[model samples]
Target chain A: MDVRTRNNVVVTGREDGPALLLAHGFGCDQNLWRLVTPILAERFRVVLFDYVGSGRSDLTAWRPQRYSRLDGYAEDVLEICRALDLRDVVFVGHSVSAMVGVLATIAEPDRFAKLVLVTPSPRYVDDGDYRGGFSQADIDELLESLESNYLGWSAAMAPVIMGNPDRPELGRELQNAFCRTDPAIARVFARTTFLADNRADLPKVPVPTLAIECAQDVIAPPEVGRYVCDQIPGCRLVTLDATGHCPQLSAPEATAEAIAGFVES
Target chain B: MSGLEQDAEDLYENAPCGYVSTLPDGTIIRINGTLLTWLGYTRDDLVGRRRFADLLTVGGRIYHETHYAPLLAMQGSISGIALELRAADGAKLPVLVSSTVKDTKVIRTVVFDARDRRTYEQELLRARRQAERLAGTLQQTLLPPSLADVPGLRIASHYHPASTDQVGGDFYDLFPLADDRWAFFLGDVSGKGAAAAVVTSLTRYTMRASAVHNPDPVAVLRDLNAVLNREYAGADRRFATVLTGLLVPDGDGFAVTMATGGHPPALLISADGSAEYQHIPGGQLVGPLRDAHFASIDLRLRPGDTLLLYTDGLTEARTAHGRYNEQALREYVLTRELTTAPALVEELTRLLAGFGEGLDDDTALLALSVPPA
Candidate 1:
């Protein structure tokens, strides 16, 4: 399908409960949240949509200059909330989407009630005072890899996402899914996701916040997750004993259970 | 075999390129056609007598046993690879060859003429060098012959292009506004190459023209934004991250009102060795939409305070082990306490040199420091 036709707002589940907005991160679209959505649908209104540059999203709206920064994606989240008139909404953002949620909440604090950040990182580049887990060289290599061979990057990155070489099928599946994205948008998103430094906005998040971390996640480790929670006020950190970056993919039942309890509490 | 069949086999053994068949240990069992012809040998001279290594140039033989042979044995086959063959005349013929173990007892090999490809590759290398030289000349033409020298402030600037062949989008300029006020800006246009260079030129000219009528930093940025949006909207969109400021001399230093359009924060280094980034929040990108909002920050530069403006290239430079981050730059400035424009530029240039190729983007640095009066 063309990218413009892909941009869609899908509302699923019961209409009576609190509304929940689900945002996927860099590589995957709303499909990443597939397993967890059904459980949330039983008790809450689950809203899922592809970001403008992503799957089934409007390619016409995907301006490279605008989407080059994470704040552009954050603006889309706020716009989506405003369109739905979603108040006291619980925003669950995965990977870089977590940082996007932070920026969106900072832009309009009244619209969001809580932010659930899944495998989120404000800054991936490590500083002497802060341990962002990856060095500048690591990110540079990633950018180089992306530029040299987009398909090769997906192939190389899939194993890291799978978290195990023994699970070759999982790596194959992840690579196949990542290959579905347009090369141009994927390149822009890759640059935007790895290059942003949103740590400054962490403390400005006034709403309740929860950072969900995957214990074995190479992308967003547990320590980084704790760092995020520590930066935001009155924020809680939870670690799932999942092996991959996408906990909602690896352990959906546990991930959904954690979110449901956190929101209810 | 009959005399007629043997004569037919002799023709196959004697074709122009050197050919050899050996056991898995590389002991020659058969040598063929032009290989025997070139090697000054006959069928009776080489059959089951010579090793394949005996036919290689000394260096080629050494490399073959050390790397090529072991690799080929492990991989089952190796091909079209460069190697030198030793001619009977003791001269080396640069050739490409393919070798594979046909069986545990024998190896099959084929040799082809590669003098043409090697010559072609050399010519290509020379042409690439010429193209790179021409690209360097074109890239320099994209930058101003020199940054406009504004009076009153000791101004020194530097523009470092990431690649000579492709022009980068980083640019900076200082010019006069009405009422004795001076307007200056440093910005990075999105993307690179000739297309980005065009946008960089457009932005610099638009900013200069807009400031003549509207000296306010915010207003000037708005005008530029309007022009850019009008020119580069829709499918052919282009945008820039810019920091524009109005410098009015106050006391000894200048009182500056800076507006940012999704650019990095400006660094204010005081004479007392204190340096801080002028943080402007919510500065949207310019030229994506018709009405893009830019944020402005006000800071009074005291005597001995030097304001350093730069593109993202500097902060995003990758180090050998890590990135040359904002914190590192801040700490570097704090330690030096640079009070003059020249001193700041010198230090920054040194830092850029240390970054080397890691700083793979155009970097523009403009520093304005007011001396104590």
Candidate 2:
């Protein structure tokens, strides 16, 4: 399948404008950028896409071996860049996507001009001395949450399932799309995202980066934001007044301005 | 305050569920009397002194931060979240929490006592896990625990299941017949799970019975075909592809008589390292049609020569280029140049494992050969 179609790519704004790619975190899709994309699109060529297993992306292509590690998602980002022939791009990644952007930049630094990491953490599970704001026990609980919360997800996804004329044959297909991910895929992705330790990859980011830390994000605490900023060479740390893990949804203007300032400067 | 304010306070305090309002960081701003009573805490012990997360166990606290807080922040509301709240006397209180963002600063939560619901969900989960375990055990019991030990011959087999969640259709067995003769068959019944399991057991038993009644390879398959065709004649028709054989002493090695019923041809690897398929053509699937055809072939197994039988799962596996069909299997066999039955089966098992997620169907394999003296 075409990479664009596989990732459910959407492009808007000026064709010749410098490209600004937006990548969302786990439990979300490209739609997380709905508020921030409009403002960024006014001045830059905005590109948005879901990960292969999330949103409208093809679920059939979700191979357990491929998505077993974060590198598969990093490969997808590189593919998107090559498919669009985007160069010197500004990548704005939120939550787990922040690490994905880190991986992509490490893979092809020439393709990215700068990076904006919002509420980002290089690692979630804490190491011996480094506090990533969560422990191994915490991630396990989160996985349990993912498993048990499917009831609400299935109920919300009922419309998509009912929209099909044939119920029996398409039942499995609808179950996969209800939470924008198949339950099996979600479990793997959750494990991959939360248990990831990308601290070693921090130094390899060849492009300048902006670490947009929310003031009150429990997921990625301030210490983590500082550690990420300290690890990347010439990485700027911007503490947004926003109080949630999703600064884009809760504080879009600040998120947009941070990206704009970094790109223009 | 209005004159109706006294009743409003009474209702808030004595509501069916506990109500607690907290800051975005879970600092308790105000909590009703019902919740304080449930947790065995006074209003003074909570108000301005503790956070909502402080009342939860360590696991619950972690869940609150990692999932509950993030979801509430992202989705604006999260309802019916199961959690355990720690009480003043070190007791655990199971509760269902529903929280909504009142504004940017405040989070309003309603908590319901869920002891009975927790017990019920545990019972259901336990029952489901038990059923799956039982299904797995039942499927294992149907297959032979060990292949028959025949003198002057080597044997090996393996079964690959696509899913542990359900029983697969593939089956194989080797058992001694009367008068120093051994009977063996490898087949795949239609469908999966308990139903396929039933048909596979039936097919295995019928093959054994037919071999005892008359050990002719052709006659054995004919008997199986008649039994299946008669039993599954109506709607929900069942069918199978089988390769049945009898092994008897031929000097130092064994003479083999094999029959096929809509199954793939068996592979023969010679002592000289040449491998080829012994295709028994014109064989029709057993069970669906009354006139199902069975064809037989006779072959001599020289010392260091091996015979291999497998289901379609090995041949029909998907690959990056295309299907790994019969031609690919033939090429694979030729390159291996296996000398013994165990060696051939072991090598094939490794190759199949390399297929990883691509091998989406159940596969069964059996190999029989004579040892070089």
Best by TM-score: 2
- lDDT per residue for candidate 1 within B75-105, as digits (tens), equals 4565555666677678766666778877563
Worst 10 residues of 2 chain B by lDDT: B62-71
TM-score of each: 0.44, 0.69
Model 2's CAPRI class is incorrect
iRMSD of all candidate structures = 19.6, 7.2
For model 1, residues A15-71, the per-residue Cα lDDT tens digits are: 988889999887667777888999999999999988986756755466788899988
Q: Deviation in angstroms for A154 in model 2?
A: 9.7
Error of 2 at B273 (Å): 26
- In the order shown, the candidates' DockQ scores are 0.01, 0.08
User: Which residue ranges in model 2 land beyond 4 Å of their true spot?
Assistant: A136-179, B1-6, B22-29, B40-77, B86-92, B100-107, B141-196, B208-218, B226-373
TM-score of chain B of each: 0.69, 0.70
lDDT of 2 by residue, A1-265 (tens): 7999989999997788889999987766787788788898888999999888887886666777888788999898999999999999998888989999999999888899999898889898889999998778867766775676422232333332333434533544533432354567767787788889999999889999999998877778899999999999999999988765778876889889988888889
Clashes of each: 8, 0
